[model samples]
Target chain A: MNNAVLLQSVRFIVLVLLQVTLLNTINLSQYINPYLYILFIITFPISDKDNRLLFIFLSFLLGLSVDLFSDSGGAHAAASVLIGYLRKPYMRFSFGVSYQQQGQKIAQSPFSQRLIYISLMILTHHLTLFFIESFSFANMMYVIQKTLLSSILTLVLILFSISMFKKKQ
Target chain B: MRQIIIFIVRNKNFLLFLLLFCFSLGITIHSHIFHRSTFINSANFISGGVYGTVTNISDYFSLKTYNNRLIDENIRLREELLKNGISEIDSTVTSSTDSTTNYVLHRAEVYKNSYKAPKNYLLINKGSHQGIKEDMGVITSGGIIGIVENTSANYAVVQSVLNTNSQINASLKNTNHFGTLSWNEKKDYRKVQLTDIPKQANIKIGDTIITGGMSSIFPKGILVGTVEKFTFNQSGNAYIIDVKLNNDMTNVGYVYIIENKDKNEIEQLLETTENE
Candidate 1:
């Protein structure tokens, strides 16, 4: 009915399609697979009303769709929901409590603040995802290596894409 | 009741997060069990159909490579026929042997193949409707792929050899020194590890590895890979081998699902033996 709802819905469909069809198929290297779909969660618009609950539910669906395509069970859902629940607090932490009063536009934020926000969220998402998917303490070091390498790639890609889109706007 | 309702409304988001988090964790744990099938996988109707459509377009790009592989395979088969001294005019097929007679092959196209994850799986187009079932072995003309974990009506999910949970019976091609072939998180898709090989067997780099057929799924002597390197596992009683797989797992397309006709009979016999 409205531009925001339409944009978010279009984003949801496009990101899921890109993830399953294009990005998931890119085996650049085993350690460097970029999870660009989480960009949808990261850049979801902040509003005046507290819709944290709705955001978390949407992210759960997002992650569940990915797991369905990838056959990864629910690891993505668990990680996405965890990050979704924490995103508000993360926003407050990175951009200060006055962010809500300032209309919390992530694109308008300082480069350092945006970097901290995206990197922290991506690292947490990757750590939880790899640990849950591996589900083994015996392979802790290996899992850590995979998490770090994949997070770096995801970070670079997300940041580069965000800046590219920002310039276009 | 008024006070409880107010409290519930206050913390509803946290409560919902907890509920969904636990539900997802339960599914993850259930999926880790090797035998039991879980609700979430790509072998279902929606995911399978999506992958099938995607691959249909992408398959054209790789048509040249697949054609080359088919040509190579045809040459190999012709050579083998010549070696057996069989003439094309003699319409009789090669005489059936115990090893080859019981195994039936069904061809399927892989709709999706994943080797990046530690617990990877493959989705194929054939399923129960095509006589495919769980525990059947999947292979390309070049080498092994995986075992069918479960099948939907029109699709099947295969637990790939690249997965950490995969363990299949494998041995050296020249000898019967059996070992358990598996993958670890440390290795890439091209390499898998073979463990429990006895210390006495003469081994070398590039030694051919093949399926042991000790299990009911794959027949004996199906090509697996070659020994990339090896070392004695801890305690020094046996060898831990690194096998370089023959298949480039990331590029799999068409595959053959091997159905061992005697799998049920063999499993039942083994079950009775264990019970006794």
Candidate 2:
């Protein structure tokens, strides 16, 4: 239990630092900006012992930290909290009955299930973030374009990182 | 009371989510609608310090290009000096004392720059300590960059010209047909739109656009852009012209902050007149 807490804390700090310092500065193009920090929320432990309230708060802080560096107001915090609250239901839908078991290990989950779960999280996060940032329906096309392209880029980075850091049994 | 407590316990998660979400939305709305609270931005100490340190390292790599730009600017200024026959040094000094035009320029380095966002901003290393303040104009050797929106002790945020919220006074090179300069809904850093020019202004593609100096923020006749394209609005009374900006906003590394000594006086006069 102590180890789990330490791991999550370390992940939080590392991801936020990587995001604000490195990923935020990489302007691949006007349409695509990969937010790899969302990986912290996506890979957070899902055991029954986990405190959901604490998770939501941590997610808000994570996004707020990014917002501070990016000058994005609170759009990131809102998106992250929304996803943080929805993560349980999303886990149930994607991971099925296994999500209800004690100490569910997401790493051991089937590949297709992980992909579905990650895609849903990234898509929801990007949609909420881009819409709120734009804050208008007049440029719906531009917002949608940005959301889709940015989500794809973020999804690829998340998946690549996951595969690269997969634990050896 | 026990039943109410149970109900509250049952819905605590939803309530917490709603509470946090509302708080965030309030911040977003507040920042989007009006001037933001200066504390919650990159200009604050920790993030500002990080950006400053990182830029200190990265700036070393771009010194050559920056040096060349400075040389080019020096040559241009010398040519202008010779043409105007000013044998003595120009009175536009950077000191606290007033010059003839009363505009003082301070040099600053861009620590962080972003052009992809709809509302983009640049963070500079200088701030209140360096005599920088909100609403002062920032320009590079190429052209205008932005206006300072906020400042901390050692850093400041400049709202870039590419932002959707930005609108500046601009006009034809030598003509008095001024209009509002702004960005289009489309995301293009290289181009901005100039609107509200009367139909009889005789505009054409490739015509030069310069700052109108109607506002105290920017002086008259600074080069802004060239006419890239032009067309009539729906009513056909004014031209909606596209301008290709002179400054490459994405490549900006250094800027000059322009402070007008008469800004407070001008604003006070306008306020008193309005109350009459």
Candidate 3:
């Protein structure tokens, strides 16, 4: 019913579609899976209407769509849901929202906290992703290599998309 | 119902989050396997569409490169068509096969190509839809590029000869000296050291390296590169010649996948002897 919630869901759907159809197919190599769709969840405002439940739900949908096209549905789910779950503690910790003021969602998240949250989530998601995809300790160096490369690329895209769409307040 | 709604509202955020999170996890675990891989597959198809759309936007500049490749390929094929009268079976190449070869030519455009990596590969625009198959040798006007690594209906990947791990038999045109062409990972020059070249054989820096055609992967005399530096390795049984590739693997745009007329037979023969 909320304007922001509806728009965010639409954005999430659009990101999932873009990620699966266009972005996923851009296999720069056997590795380097770019995760641009995380932008949807990252940009979702922390409001009463759009709470943690919506975050996880939308994240799962986006991730599942990507993983299917990506040939690893569980992979994106694990990462997306992890991002979703951690978003709460992450928001609480970095945003400096007091425990008593928990229900007060920040309409315009500060750039510093947003950067930190996005970086940690992106790092976390990519680490789990490439590790599970490579699935071998034997490929220790390569797995790490893939993780770093994909994360950097995905991070750049996430930052670009969020800044482009988010209204400055 | 009123009490339950009140309780749920009190913890709506947490409960809703958990439920959605769990639901997504359930779908994910199931979708990972082939049993429910259709979802992921559909997702891939959707992603493929999106990729196609985005490429369309950025394809303007790349179009120049793509057009240049097409022109080059067109000229080569047309010239052959004129001299061979479109029926002489490409006399530029001579085969030892007992029967007339039935070579089929397929057009493929390189989509994603990389040579910076140790094991380099290229993804082409053509796939099973364009009659591409696994192990089909891909080439360009320059020379032998690589072999098909994977294939879908719309796209396929080629294992580039520039890859460090790539091994193909080649010989010096002048002295009949032979060795393997391997990537020198340290340099962008793509100097392939022709190993096992008879120590006594004459090899000059300007000498040419061509496919020996000892194997079916590539035809004979397709230029691999030219000797940049020639010397005996630690083991003097061969001359380790540094070959400078003529076709820059990094700039590959348009490629012609050479389908050996007798590839199946060649494969069969090799497979039979592999056990021995």
Candidate 4:
């Protein structure tokens, strides 16, 4: 396999392990369970934009693995696939023509640009996950609080991990 | 055929996303408490094995607390034995010999639990092999926990009272006025909502709530919760009451699976009556 595929495979395994064994156990508060696994999809190579099928499949697999361990049924899988579907549009929207022309790695982007990209991706992911898990809009405030807090926590962790292990592009 | 192929190739990405998204949503719906999700629950082999191992490890660290809970339950049982005699204490065991006994309780340990979700479910170690079946009422010493939703060969999944779909027949301790007991999906695990009580029913804060026994699943007087607060609904004809659950749903360790002895017979009679 090529370097990108190999690297993504390793990241998938590592993130799933971290999520199930470590992160999922850390229930800081009822509403603040940080889901750091979505970072796998967040940092997935944008060069693979043409290979949408592979991207969606990998996202589904990643989410199903986490759901199996966490026993959350398919909430994660649904949310992850949604993020995977929207990733290209979001990147285009955030970075505009520069993203398409340069094919720049999102992690290597300027801090402000990267922040918007990661925050929106994480927010969409967390909102879908919490909503599907609840399957109801009855407790609107509770859902909003969970989505906001978890998105912030996930975004921070993803940003930190990206900075710490950023490739020398 | 060329035109069809072109169309397929043009929108392949959107089509694939729709397919997978719907697949995942189907899974979510199937696993919901409202659906009779007998399969694909967390009690399946792989997930159950992982959770069981994790619970086993955690159970060791909480041995002291577990032991204390068992001791407390034992004391309560002994007190009941002393006060009500062996027949009542052994109600779960003596149902075969005594025709009057309506419910039998079997002990099971929790394998996994989730309270943070809007629709929480509990995995218990007992299953069909242990005489546990779907729709059987489950409880701890403190009060009602939930009803068994599905069971495998060696495990069962409980639809916790914390779930939005849970609706149990519950009544006031002092009066016959009863309502449907359900959860508001709030973060707090200690509270549930009781609705449909008529406005004229004299209910006060701290008034006890228990199983109405109108249904065959739970016996009469099984403690459910206590009325915490109440308000008149928009119609002004019924009251919606907030109930404080007696059991801490998040901390349940051991539970009792209640099997109503005459459920099948009663259900059959009802079916016949309806048919007639």
TM-score, candidate 3, is: 0.61
Would you list the clashing residue pairs of candidate 2?
none
Spell out the clash pairs found in candidate 3: A20-B47, A21-B46, A21-B47, A21-B48, A22-B47, A22-B50, A22-B51, A53-B17, A68-B40, A69-B44
DockQ of every model listed? 0.80, 0.70, 0.31, 0.57
- On the 0 to 100 scale, the lDDT of residue B212 in model 2 is 90
Docking class of 4: medium
Tens digits of lDDT, candidate 2, B151-249: 999999999988888999999985789999988647477889999999989987889999999999999878898999998999999999999999887
Candidate 1 accuracy as lDDT: 0.89
Backbone collisions counted per model: 0, 0, 10, 0
Q: Which prediction has more favorable lDDT, 1 or 4?
A: 1
- List native contact recovery per candidate, as a fraction of 1: 0.73, 0.57, 0.41, 0.52
At residue B124, candidate 3 shows an lDDT of: 72
TM-score for chain B of all predictions: 0.95, 0.92, 0.69, 0.89
Residue-level lDDT tens digits of model 1 in B1-276: 999999989998888889888988988998987444788988888888789889999999999999999999999988988987766536466466536878999999999998888889999999999999999999999889999998999999999999888899999988799999999867888999999999998999999999998999898888999999999988998999999999999899899999999888999999999999
Best DockQ goes to which candidate? 1
Task: For each candidate in turn, give its C-alpha RMSD to the true structure in angstroms.
Answer: 1.9, 2.6, 7.6, 3.2
Residue B232 of model 2 has an lDDT of 95
Ranking the candidates on DockQ from highest down gives 1, 2, 4, 3
Per-residue lDDT over A1-169 for candidate 2, one digit per residue giving the tens place of the 0 to 100 score? 8998898889888887788777777867788888899899998865556568888888888889888988888889999999998898888899886667645466668889888999999989999998888888898899889889999889889989988888898
Docking quality of model 2: it rates as medium
Q: What is the lDDT for A65 in model 3? A: 70
